[model samples]
Structure formats: structure tokens, C-alpha cells
Target: MLIIFSIPWLVWRLLKTDYFAPLVVVQIVMGIVLGPGVLGHWFPAYYEFVFTPTVVHSLNGIAWWSVMLFVMIAGVELDLGKAWQHRRESGITAGLALGAPLLLGCGAAAVLLGFDGWMGPKAQTWQFVVGIGMACAVTALPILILLMEKLDILRQPLGQRILRYASLDDIAIWGVLALILMDWSRIGKQLAFLIAFVVLGLAFRRLMAWLDEADRWYVAPIWLALCGLGADWAGLHFMVGAFLAGAIMDGHWFNQEKLDLLRHHVLLVMMPVFFLSTGLRTNWAVGGTEVFAAAALLLVASVAGKLIGVRIAARVLHWAPGEASIIGWLLQTKALIMIIFANILLDKQVITSEAFTALLLMAVASTMLTVPMVEPQMRRSRALAGSAGQST
Candidate 1:
């Protein structure tokens, strides 16, 4: 552990677009060895610490914490009151984000082919395809934060506007997922579950408001943790409940900044554990040609669909050409939700191991690609902003 940190952190200063990428890659490779793919296969007891049932539960906890922190931050960062003012453009971007990704996923599924074993068409192919497609969105929130910080556009009106609509875009994704899960067959009691969800959402908002008015940020996450258990008790996945609670608080009196501070610690501390743990589940060997070919199609379609949809939506919002373009490309950073949905589907057996492998590789590839494409725009936006400042 000490040796790993002593290995020169300064090296990552060069590739500034999400420094976590390379580190995550290294961890993932190590995980492949220590996980079921290698050590779990050959020396089960040697790698046993990594995936004991207890460790599995810990990993699950980390993932839920990572995402719940994300949602809490979403609630904190978005100026929900201001966002409602632009209901028109926000509506369109939300609509497009949901519609475009689903379409792209479906397209990817159509040309989809798979394999044998506990891997491929041994299960539900079409359902897998539809699930994958529906789950392929690259959310704009985190990517925008990173992009704006890099470009010095964090405080600009364009940035604020981007935040405005993109915040709603964040909310819309969850709402849509909740809607989809509401009807999902395995979920079984979808209607009763959904009704309970809405009720919980209302209660969550009130919970946030009370905490905020009382000036107690510490209590917020406790409330969230409780909500997780409550959701479980109500026969819905706790993560889904946590997400809805965040979405429900969008325009409420919650101190977004306060929650942000609280979640920062957890997000940094627990998230890597979650990622490595999740990465351990992936058996990269089983995902061969059929999966690769499908991933190829999915990647091309996702890039095109999101870039085109966002660009057009940006124009409708009256964004400058360059802002529109950068926003469009950067929004294709689709790592978090993509991985979550994939895990859910894979666990459900809707998608085979082959498709999961394909999706993981391609989604990571697209996310990595989005950063490079965004760097140029970051430079251009900064130079343009600087020149304008000097002229003024």
C-alpha cells in the first residue's frame, strides 16, 4: 500500500483528462488476476479475501454509496428552481437523452450476436438488447463539471445554462429508469413498488427540507441510509429508492452545498472499492468476436446518437456553435449509469456474460474517447473566453 502511493503521483499530471482512468485501469487489471478470471479459477483460497460473501456485500455497499453520493451531489449542485424556468429546452434535452440512448441501444441490439456457455443466447437475447440499449446513456452532469473546470467556464452563463438543463437531464434519466423498472417483470410488484416509491420520494423531500432548515448536513446522509433500508422493506431496490429520493429533492430546500461536502468524503473513499469490486465480476475472456462486433455497432451509434441529439438540442436552446458542439461530444461520457444498468441486467440474466463483456469494453472506450475529443474544445472555449475578456 505504501509502496503503491510512493510510486510518483506527479506522473498523472500530464494526462489531465480524468486522472482516475489510468489508475482505474491498473486496478482493473490487478482485479482480473485476483478475481474469478485467474486467481478465483486457479488458487481459490489465495484470492479468497477479494470475493468472500462478506466482501461482495461490502462491494455492493460501496457501489450504492458511490451512486447515492452522486445523486446527493446532483441534488446539491443543480439550481432546481432556476431550471424549471427553462422547461422547454430542458424538456427537449431530457427527452432526447432518454430517447437517443434507447434508440442507439436498440440499434446495437439488432445487429447483436453472442456465444455459448453461461455466456450468450443461453438466455434472453432480445430482452438483453433492449435493456442494454435503454441503459446506454452518457450523462452530462459529471462530465460537464470536469469539462467546465478544465475550460475555465465554470462560472459562465453558458456553463450555468449547461448546468441548468443538464441538471434536469440528470433528473430525467432517473425518472425514466424508475419508470422502466416499474414495469420490469422480475420486479414483479411494479405498481405497488412504484406507488411506494412516489410516497417515499415525497417523504424524502420533506426530510431534506427539515434537515436544511435545521442546518444539519450530517443528518442528510443518515436519512438517505434509512431510505435505502425503507426501499428494501417496500420491495424495491434500495439504489432505485436512493436515486428517486435525490430526484425528488431537485427543486426542494435541501442545502445542495452542504450535502456536496458530506458526499465528497464518501465518494472519494468508497467509490474505488466499488469500481474494483464491480470490475472483478467481469470475465473479459468470454466476450469474444460476437460481443466485439456488437460493441462496435453500439459505440458508433451511441457517439452519433448522443452527439447529434445534443447538438440539435443545444441549438434549440440557442447555444453558440462551439459551446453546443463541445457539450454534445462531452456528454457521451457514459461510464457510471452504463455500468450500473449492465450489472443489473447481467444479474437478471437478461444479458449474457458475452454481451456484458462487450458492453463494458465499448462503454469504457467511449468514455475514454470523450475526454480526448473534449480537450480541444476546452482549449478553444478558454481561448475564446480569454480573448473576449481582454477585448472587454
Candidate 2:
């Protein structure tokens, strides 16, 4: 446990990877480095000794709950009301932002289908294509907020617009996941779960409303656990349930400072375990060259499609020069959320370990590119604004 936490943190600080790769990104990369394909292959005996079945099992438990809590917090941070207020703009941007990449990513998946080891044993062609497509379209909303705050734009007008766009896309991403996970045999159970959720959700809201703020904090996790178990039992997966658990609650109910702290602490203390676990699942049996090639293909599709989509929106909406570039790059940030999305697909056997590894690489590359790409465009925008102000 200490090794898992300390190694990534030490590497992050010592290497000063934060100029492009933040601590979260570093942790994810370290996880991949520590996984079977890399570390285990290099030193099989040591790897086995360190990550024994019992040890791995214990770590898996921690990873699951850590990710569940992080995802739930992401759900709480979503502000659909704000998205609705700027519905026209948000809708158009979100639709295009999600659509173009999904279409292109499906194309990429289709190509991979021509080859072996890309699709999971259990996945139908459509499920594999659509699941991979949606992974390309996801924006890590929590990470976006963090990055924007780092850029000193989180509370700015442009930041708010980006948030609104991401919020809408986040909804679409999860809806598509639920669609992909739909099972005809379990349809009845799924429907029952949804029906129960509606009724229970109403009651949960009422109970939350009546509770003291202090008590509400204590009650939230109990609700989270029940919903997670219910979702998993219904075959939708517990992560979905964790998300739904957070979605129904209003963020305004809690103290903003405390909520932010909660998110930070969760990332700091627990999410490294989740990252490591995610890495351990990556496979290179398809060969490392093949995996890297696949990742490169997905990255191109993801980045290009996002820029194309946003550029179209820019033309349609008459956005300022270079604005689309900034928004497109920022929206393509995909570290945690895409990893989570891929994990679910892997858990359901919709994608093979090779595919998951490729997607993981694509996500890391996408996130690392974000801040560096955006900073220059932002400087240009600021310069333009300043010159305009001076002339005025």
C-alpha cells in the first residue's frame, strides 16, 4: 500500500511532470508501469511475490470503493440546471462534441474488428463499436474543473461555458453506457431497479431535505452503498449505481469548501489504488507494438474528431477566433472518466484487455496534451482582449 501511494507521488514531484502530466496523470502512468505487461514481464518472480492473489484481492476491494466514491462525487458536481439555462448553446456544442468523436471512434473500432484481440469474447460487434466510441467522447468533468482552476479560469465566463458543455456531454456518455449494458435476459430486473430507484429516489430526497447538514453527510454513503448494491444486483454494474446515487442529490446541500476538500482527499488518498488496479488489468498479449498502434489510432480519432466538432460549432455560433481550439482541447481531457468508462466495459467483458490497454494509453495521452495545448491559445485570447480594451 505504501509503495503504491509513495512511488507515484515521489515520481510526480521529483520529475516535475506537472508541467503537462499532473499528479493524477502521473499516478495513472505509474500504474501502467507497475502492471503485468511491464513490471510483471520484467521481473515475474518479484511481481508475483508483491502482488499475490490475496494482496491483489485486498487491493481490488479498496480500488472498487475508492472509484465508486470518486464517481459519486463527479455525479454530485454535475450541474444540469446551469446547462439548461444556456440550453441552446450547450446542446449544440455538447451534441457535436460527443457525436463526431463517437462516429470516428466507431470507425476505428470497426477497423480493429478486422483484427483479432481487440473485441472481447462476450461482446457483440455493435456493443464493442459503440462502447469504444463512447470512450473517445467522454470528458473528465472533475479533472476539467481542476485543470481550469489551475489555468485560473474555473470561475470565468469561458470556463462556465465549457462546464456547461461538459455537463451535457457527461449525461450523454452515461446514457449511452446504460444503453450498451442493456441485457434482454435481465431487462426485467433492470426495469424493476429503475422503477424502485424512482420511488426510492423521491423518498431519499425527502429524507435528505429533512436532515441536518451534519447528518446528511453521514447518510449519503449509506445511500451510496445501497444504490451500488442494487445496481450491481440488477446487472447494470455498481459504478452506474454509484453515479445514480450522487446524481439525485443536489450539490448545494453541502458546504462548497468541504465538498471540494472531499474530492481532493479522495484523489490524494484512494484513487492511486484505483489507478494501480486499472493498470494491472492491462494486457499486452496482442503485443506491445499493436497496443501502442491502437492507442495512437484512437488518440487521432479522438483529438481530431473533437476539434472538428467544436470548429463546426464555432462557425455556427460565431465564436471568437481561436476560441474553438481552446474549448476543443479542454473538452478532450479524458483521464479519470475515460478510464472509469473503459473499466466498466472490461468488467462486463465488452472489450478485451488489449482494447482496454489501448484506451488507457489514449486517455493518458489525451489528458497530457490538454494544458499545454490550451495555455498558448488562452494567452492569445488574453492578448486580443487586452488590445481591444486598450483601443476602446
Candidate 3:
């Protein structure tokens, strides 16, 4: 863990390129380098000693809980009511942002199906296509928040608008994931679980309303565990349940400062283990060229599709000229959520390790590109807006 955390910090400090590649992205890259693909290959005995089966198992447990907490926080943080208040703009932007990349990514997935190492054994053609498509469309809401905070825009009107689009897309991304993961054989249980969850969700909300803030925090984890277990038992996976667990709860129940601190601490302390575990899963058995080629394809599809979609929305909505580019690049940021999405796909045997590696690379590259691409455009826009206001 020390090695995992230290390497990324050292790189970030030495390079001093936090604007281009934040510590999180560096950590992700370090995970890949430290995985069997690099470190394990160069120093087999050290890699084996450090990441023995027992140690890997421990890391997996930490990764699981860490991601669960993170996902739940994402769910709770969603400002659905605000999105609904601006329904038309939010709906149009969110739909275009999500749909365009999804279609392009599906096309890419179809192309990949011609190859040997991309599809999992259990995945149907549609599942693979849709899963990959959703991956391309995903915006890592948590990471988006972190980046916006770093860019000093988290409280700005523009930032809030972007958050609305991302929040809606976040909901759709998980819904699509649930659809992809639907077990036909377990349909009965799944339906029952949904029904029970709705009823229990109402009860849970009431319970939360009745509880004091301190008590609510205390009961939150128990609620998370129960929901997660129930969802997994119904074949939907615990992560889905974790998301649902928080999505139903009102963020207003908790102090905003406290929630933010919890999120920061989770990322600080626990998410590195998750990143390392993610790296450990990376495999290059399908050949590095093929993996990288696939990554490039997906990255292009993700970036281009996002830009095109947002441009279309801007045109229709009559947004100012440079706004689409800024929004598109920002929305294209995907790291933690997309990785988690791909991890679930790999776990369910819907995508091969090769596909997972490609997705991982795509996510890292996409995230790294965001701040650099958006900063200048955002500054220009702000300058233009300021001049217009002064002239007025």
C-alpha cells in the first residue's frame, strides 16, 4: 500500500503536472506499471513476494469496500431535483452526451468482435457491444467533482450545469449496467427484489427522517450492507445495491462539509488500494500492440463522440460558440466510475482481460486529457463573458 501510494505522489511531485495528470491518474498509471505487466515481469520475486495470493485477497476486500463507499457517495451526491428543475436543457444535453458515444462505441465494439481477445465467454454480442458502448459514454461523476474542485469551478454556475448533465448520465449509466447484467434465470428474484427495495426504500427514508444526523450516519453502513447483499442475492451485484442504497437517501440529511471530507478521506486512504487491485487485474496476454490499438480506438470514439454530441446540443440550444468544446471535454473525463464499470463487466465474464485493459487505458487517457483541454477554453469564455458584461 505504501508503495502504491508513494510512487504516484513522487511522480506527481517530481513532474509537477497536476493540471494535466492529477495524482489519481498517476496512481492509476502506477498501478499498471506495478502490475504483472511491468514490475512483475521485471522483478518476479519481488512482485510475487509483495502481491502473494493472500495479500491480493486482502487488497480485493479493501477495494470492494472502498468502491462501495465511493459509489454510494456518488449516488448520494446526485442533484436529481436540480436536474429536474431544468428538465429540458438537462435532458437534451444528457441524452446527446450519453447516446452519441454509446452508438459510436457500439460500432467500435462490433469492429472488435472480429478480433479474438475482446469478448468474454459468457457475453452475447449485444451485451458486449452495449457494455462497451456504455463504458465509452460514462462520466466519472466523483472524479468530475474532484477535478472541478481542483480547477476552482465547483461552485460556479457553469460547474453546476455540468454537474446536472453528469448526474443524469450517471443514473443512466448504472441503469444500462443493470440491464446488461440482468440474469434471465434470476428474473423472478430480481423483480421481487426491486419491489421489496421500493417498499423498503420508502421505509428507509422515513427512518432516516426520524433519526438524528449522528444516528443516521451510524445506521447508514448497515443500510448499505443490507441493500448490497439483497441486490447481489438477486443477481444484480453488490455495487449496484450500494449505489441504490445511497441514491434513495437525501444528501440534505448530512452536512455538506462532512460529506466532502468523507469523500476526500476515502479517496486518500482507500482508493489507492482499489487502483492497485485494478492494476493487478491488467493482463497483456493478448499482446500489447493489440491492447493499445484497441485503447486508441475506444479513446477516439469516446472523445470524438462526446465532442460531436455536445456540439450538437450547443447548436440546438444556441449556446455560445466555445461552450460546447469546454463542456464536451469536461464531460469526457472518466476514470474511477468507468474503471469500476469495466471491472464489473470483467467480473461477470462479459469482457475479456484484453478488453478490460483497453478500457482502463481509455479511461486514464480520457481523464488526463480533460484539464489541459478545458482550461484555456474556459478562461477564454470567462474573459468574453466578462467583457460583454462590462460593455453592457
Candidate 4:
């Protein structure tokens, strides 16, 4: 109920600002201060009402819908017309992006092993470690697109190339995570479920098409949202359904403009509550001078890891240095996506509360620090591009 108004307010705010440093950090800092660490002490019951067992369970439901809407808009905004304009290069770039993260993340898990606060306890430690690699391997394309637009590179050749790469990257990450989840070892069962997933996906389209013909666009989100619940019931995690629902809706019939309109509707309306809800989850009491140091370390690691991985991959793929650096800087961006996985781990009891707290702090603080460091270069790049155009 409270989520209804809360998300819209946040969306309104996000619309007015550039996301790099200015937008994401403000939310994280405000979230930290308003978080349970501060608010819990000052008003424990009020905090509880918003983040309580029942409330979070409810927020989980809202978050589930948010995920679907987020992905659906990604699919819709995707220039289906440009699919062939750069298919070969897009494929190679996407492959490089996904493969590097997969190997590096999985390998890096040796140092940060047993860190699946998001993988949950039902899955083994190795699986969680695998999830860690998979988590880092993902590129949140929704956020990436937003960043690209903000940087004003949306029409450049390199921009289009990275956009395609990021889209394909999103698809691969979803598939990899599906493979990395629980009940993974039983090949026969997994195969059956894979087949079933395809069947259900096809059926979802037929059903939605019929409904759309009958003027039922509203039903699409609701139906898709319910499928998330069904996925959870089947132990596949609701996000699996959420992702599948999005990909299913990617066909030609779901009007892109309509979806775009819907995108703002949710973003401006219901999304901020989710952000606030996310803030409410952080515990800032752990703050200290050293905590700041560690926060800085996490921020550096998060950005550096992505920059190095993507930069090397970009060069290998023969991208211009300019494009490579932009991709690096852009991909370095992080969001609540990492925090989501970490909290899942906490809920599954796979990690200690302190570790969960630390990672949550890491995510918020990392995102906060991201903008300040990245913005100057982004502005410079834009300015340079402008000067070069005039000179040429």
C-alpha cells in the first residue's frame, strides 16, 4: 500500500538528474541515514512496519513486479530494427563481456569464496560461489541504457554497439543464473524443466496475444507477475518467472511506445518505494573511520574489476579506445542488483548478518562513490566529442 506512492516520488526525482554520481549516491546516502541503523534506534516500530517480516514479504512481491517491468521495458526499447545492423559485432562484444566475467568472477571467488548471501542456504557453497561469479557476470542493461543516454552517446556507433552487447549480455546472464540455481545436478530433471520452460513461454505469448486482441494490456503485467509467484512455488525463484515473462513479451505485438509509457508510470510511481525499502535494509551503525576505508575499498574493487574486465575485452574485440573506455566506465556502474543477491543470501542464512551488513554497505557506498569518480571523465568525453565534431 505504501509502496504505491513511494515509487512514483523516487521516479520523479530520478527523471530530473543524471544517474552517474548525482543520482545514485544521493539515494544511497539518504538511505543509509534513513536506514535501520539510524531509524531503528530512533523509531524501531516505524522501521519495523516498513521492513517487518510481513512488510518485506509484501515488498518482495512489489519488487518482483518491478523486475518484470524493468526487463520488459528493456526488451521494448531494444531497437529490434537494428538487430542485423551490427549482429556480428554485437555478438562478439556480448560474448567477450559475458565470458570474461564468467571466468574472472568464478576464479576470483577463490579469494571471495563462500560469499553467496544471495544464493541462499539451500544451494551448496560451491553453488553460491558460482552464483557470485554469475552475479558479477551480469550487466543490468536497464541501468546501462539509462547511463548511455545520460552520457549522450545513444546515437553514436559505439553506443549502438555497446547497447546491443549489453542486451545480449542480459540474456546470457539470465540463462547462466538459471543454470546456476538449485536442483542443478539432476540433468534429467533440469532438462525436463528446461523443456517445460520453453513450452510455458510459448503458451504465455499465445495467452497474452489473445488478451491483447481483447484489449487487455493491463492483464499482461498481472499475469506475468503471478507467474513469478508460481516460479517461487516451484522453487525456481520468482525472478526466473520475472525474466521469462519479460523475454516472452519481447515479440512484435507489445507496442514499444505503450511499454515506454508504462515504463515511466512504474518508474515514476512505484519504484522509489522499492528504493526506500532497499535503504531501510541497510545497517549504518557499523560506520566508523575504518568502515569508510572498507567502503572505499569495495567501491574501488567494484569499479576496477568491471573496468579492467570490460576494457581488456573491448580491446580484444577491436573496439576503438574511446569506445572501450566508455564501455568500461559505463559498465562500471552498479545498482541495487548486487544488493538483491546479497540480501537473498542473508535470507537463506548462508552468510552472517554482519557479512550481509558489510556487503549491503558495500553496495550502497560503492554506488555512491561511482558517480563522483566517473562523472568528470564522462563530461570530458562528451566535451571532447563536441570539439572534434566542430573541428572536423
Top-lDDT structure, candidate number: 3
For model 2, residues 1-392, the per-residue Cα lDDT tens digits are 88788999899999998979999999999999999999999999999989999989999999999999998998888899998888989999999999999999999999999999999888999999999999998999999999999999999999999999998898888888888999989999999999999999999999999999999899999999999999999999999999999999999888889999999999999999999999999999999999999999999999999999999999999998899999999999999999999999999999999999999999999999999999988898999999999999
> Which residue ranges in model 1 land beyond 4 Å of their true spot?
1-54, 75-78, 113-127, 183-189, 197-208, 211-215, 233-235, 250-257, 314-318, 384-392
Ranking by lDDT: 3, 2, 1, 4
Question: Could you tell me the lDDT of residue 329 within candidate 3?
Answer: 95
Candidate 4 TM-score to native: 0.77
Superposition error at 250 for model 2 (Å): 0.6
Give TM-scores for every candidate, taking all chains together and pairing residue i with residue i. Answer: 0.79, 0.99, 0.98, 0.77
TM-score-best of 3 and 4: 3
Report the number of backbone clashes for model 4.
Answer: 13
lDDT of 1 by residue, 3-64 (tens): 12222223334444254354433333343445565667788786686467886786776676
lDDT of each: 0.61, 0.94, 0.94, 0.59
- Compare the candidates by TM-score and give the number of the best one: 2
Per-residue lDDT of candidate 4, residues 140-214 (tens digit)? 566666566666676777667777777776677666656655554455655655577688778777776676543
Q: For model 4, state the Cα shift of residue 356 in Å.
A: 4.1
Q: Candidate 1: RMSD over Cα atoms? A: 4.2
| Clashing residue pairs found in predicted model 1 | 76-256, 105-133
Ranking by TM-score: 2, 3, 1, 4
Regions of model 4 farther than 4 Å from truth: 1-25, 41-60, 75-87, 99-109, 112-123, 184-193, 206-216, 283-298, 347-356, 365-392
